[model samples]
Target: MSKILVTGGLGFIGSHTVVELQKEGFEVVIIDNLSNSSINVLDGITAITGKKPIFEKLDLREKSAVQEFFKTHNDVKGVIHFAASKAVGESVENPLLYYENNINTLVYVLQELNKLKEANFIFSSSCTVYGQADELPITENAPVKPAESPYGNTKQIGEEIIKDTCKVSAQLNAIALRYFNPVGSHESALIGELPIGVPQNLVPFITQTAIGLREQLSVFGDDYPTEDGTCIRDYIHVVDLAKAHVVALQRLLAHKNETNFEVFNLGTGTGSSVLEVIKSFERVSGETLNYKIAPRRAGDVIAAYAHTEKANKVLGWKSDLTLDDAMASAWKWEKHIREQ
Candidate 1:
């Protein structure tokens, strides 16, 4: 069995990917600093998979530590990098931190991989890179606009770095999956999103509000030119997004004479407005949610979704879960965390 290393394995997306990788019969090792997540997520993962991954508490920002980690785990076949400071609002306030953490860690990891004879690398990119795309159902060929915020810029820069690195390095092959609004939890609800402070994403905030952890939701602008006059997004189930990473990794390992770098969009290909999401949550949980229309957030896009034909055609993967299913699964996980 080939062993794989997942950075930020304790995070929301990383944990789900770990479960999916384990189910595919891969030996998994995780590296996390526990800065924005908890070790308890390991228990949640084990509860569902009945197998715990090998984990190391190491921060990738430290150059020496990252070098030593790769040295110690020299046999790692592929790397799935999910570690980064990913808050848009916070990134604006602290741009340097985002640049350092997001850029430095990726460079360090790639540096380590450059030594290997052959290695596959998967990076977590975001739809924010396509700021207010001129067209609907954005594709991988969509032109990347100037990033709206520092956080989004980091993702753009990260992708560029990987592309440049792959240009000269024969040992590394990379795929950057540009994701659009990943939400929901695993079906078992044993492992789900665990936001540290106030939740930045829509589904988590909605779930927290339903559980009374938060008093209400903020619908950031209703003046946008759309059916509901609010921002729209393609919310993909976390599990489906997780499965894409595995497929991307497999593709990199199989293909030869392929460009060392490639990108694919991961989304449901359907747009959902903020109002629609709240309504869906209310229907799923049978709970009234308090919300107010606030001013437009500075960095938010009015609407964005994906044209997933590339992923579907190339990787033979498509999202299987629906919005209602995502909401229900998230609500179940919220309840489980509250009781525990």
Candidate 2:
């Protein structure tokens, strides 16, 4: 079995991907700083997979530590890079931190991969790179708009960095999975999104409000052109998104005649408005959410989903979970977290 390195493996998506990788018969090694995640995620992952991955408490920003990690673990077959500062509002407030954490860590990881003879590099890119696209379902070829925040700019820059690295390094084959809104949790509620501080995403806020951890959810805007006047997004289950990483890694390892730097949009190809999501949560969890309409948030796109055809045709993957299933899973995870 090939060993795969998962940076930020204890995080919401990273942990879920670890479980999928293990289930697919891949040996897993995890490196997480635990700055934004809990060590207990290891326990949760073990509870689900019946096997705990090899974990290291190392920060990727420190070039030496990352190099040492690669040096010590020379058998690593591929890397799923998920370690980054990912908050749009916080990125706008602190651009330097975002640049430092997001860019530097990627550089260090690529530096290590360049030394290997054969290695696959998977990146966690975002739909924010599209900014506010003119089309409804964004495709891989969609024109990338001027990034609305520093965090988004990092993804654009990160993709550029990977492309440039792949141009010179034959050992490196990279895939940038441009993700849309990723919500929900693992089916067992063992590991899920544990956003630090106030949640920036909508699903977390809705879950928190339903759990009574917060006063009420704030619907950023109710005046959009969409139905019920709220912004629309294609929310993919976190587990489904995690499986995409596994598929992409397999694609790269199989040498499927793809470009050295390829991009795929991972989404369900269906848009759901904020009000629609709230209703879905209510229907799934039987909880009425208290929310109010607020002014349009700056940098928010009215609607953004993915074309997803490239991912389906190339990687042989598609989303199987529905919005209600995602909400139910998320509600289960939120209740479990509250109990803990």
Candidate 3:
């Protein structure tokens, strides 16, 4: 089994990916600073996979520590980089933090990968790069627009950095997965999105409100030009997104990449409004959510979903879970975590 390094492996999506990788017989190592995630997630991963991956509490932003990690684990066959500050609102307020955490750390990691004879790299990217696309279902061929937030800008810059790095580093092959909103939890109800403070993402916030952690959920807007007059996003289950990472890795490892640098959009290809999400949560959890229609949030697109045919036919992966399924699993995990 080839050893794979998953940065931010203890995070919501990262933890799920670790379980999937372990189940696939891949030796896994995790690097997380526990900034946005907790160490206890390893237990959830172990419970599911029956194997605990090697974990190191290291921040990728520290260039020396990142290099040291590569030195300590010289046998790493591939790297999946996902340890970045990901909140759009927070990024708007703290732009420097987003750049340093998202961009500088990426450079440090790629620099270390350049030292290796050969490497396969998978970058955790977001669909925010589209920035309110002109078309209904955004495709990989969609022109990259000006990012609406600092966090989105970081993803755009990160992809550019990888493309440029891959151009120079002939031995490196990388893929950037521009994923849509990722929700849900592992079916075991052990690991899920554990936001430190108030939840930034909608699904977690919805769960928190239902669980009484929050007074009420705020629907960002109900005036947008959509079916529900709210912002629409393609919410794919986190488990499905994790599987896509594995598929992208296999493509790079098998030398199937047409170019050293490539990208794929991961989503369910169906847009769901914020109100619809709340409705889905209510249906699955059997709890009427206390939500209010709030003002439109900054940096939020009216509608953003994916044209996942590329991911479907090219990467051989498509989202299998719907909004209801994701919300149901998230509700289960929320109840489980609260009772713990």
Q: Runs in model 3 with CA error above 4 Å?
A: none
Give the deviation of candidate 2 from the true structure as CA RMSD.
0.8
lDDT of 1 by residue, 205-323 (tens): 99999899999889999999999899999999999999999988888777732578888999999999999999988898898999999999887788999999988997778999999
lDDT of 3 by residue, 1-340 (tens): 9999999999999999999999899999999999999999999999999998999999888899998899999889999999999998899999999999999999999999999999999999999999989998999999999989999999999999999999899999999999999999999998999998988889889999998999998887789989879999999999999999999998998999999999999999999988888889989889999999888887778999999999999889988888899999999999999898
Q: Which candidate order results from sorting by lDDT in descending order? A: 2, 3, 1
RMSD to native, candidate 1: 1.0
Off by over 4 Å in 2: none
Query: What's each prediction's clash count?
Result: 0, 0, 0
Q: lDDT of each structure? A: 0.93, 0.94, 0.93
Q: Where is model 2 poorest over a 10-residue stretch in terms of lDDT?
A: 251-260
Ten-residue stretch with the least lDDT total in model 1: 251-260
Better of 1 and 2 by lDDT: 2
As a whole number from 0 to 100, the lDDT of residue 213 in candidate 3 is 93
Report residue 291 deviation for candidate 1 (angstroms): 1.2
Of 2 and 3, the candidate ahead on lDDT is: 2
lDDT of 1 at 305: 95
TM-score of 3: 0.99
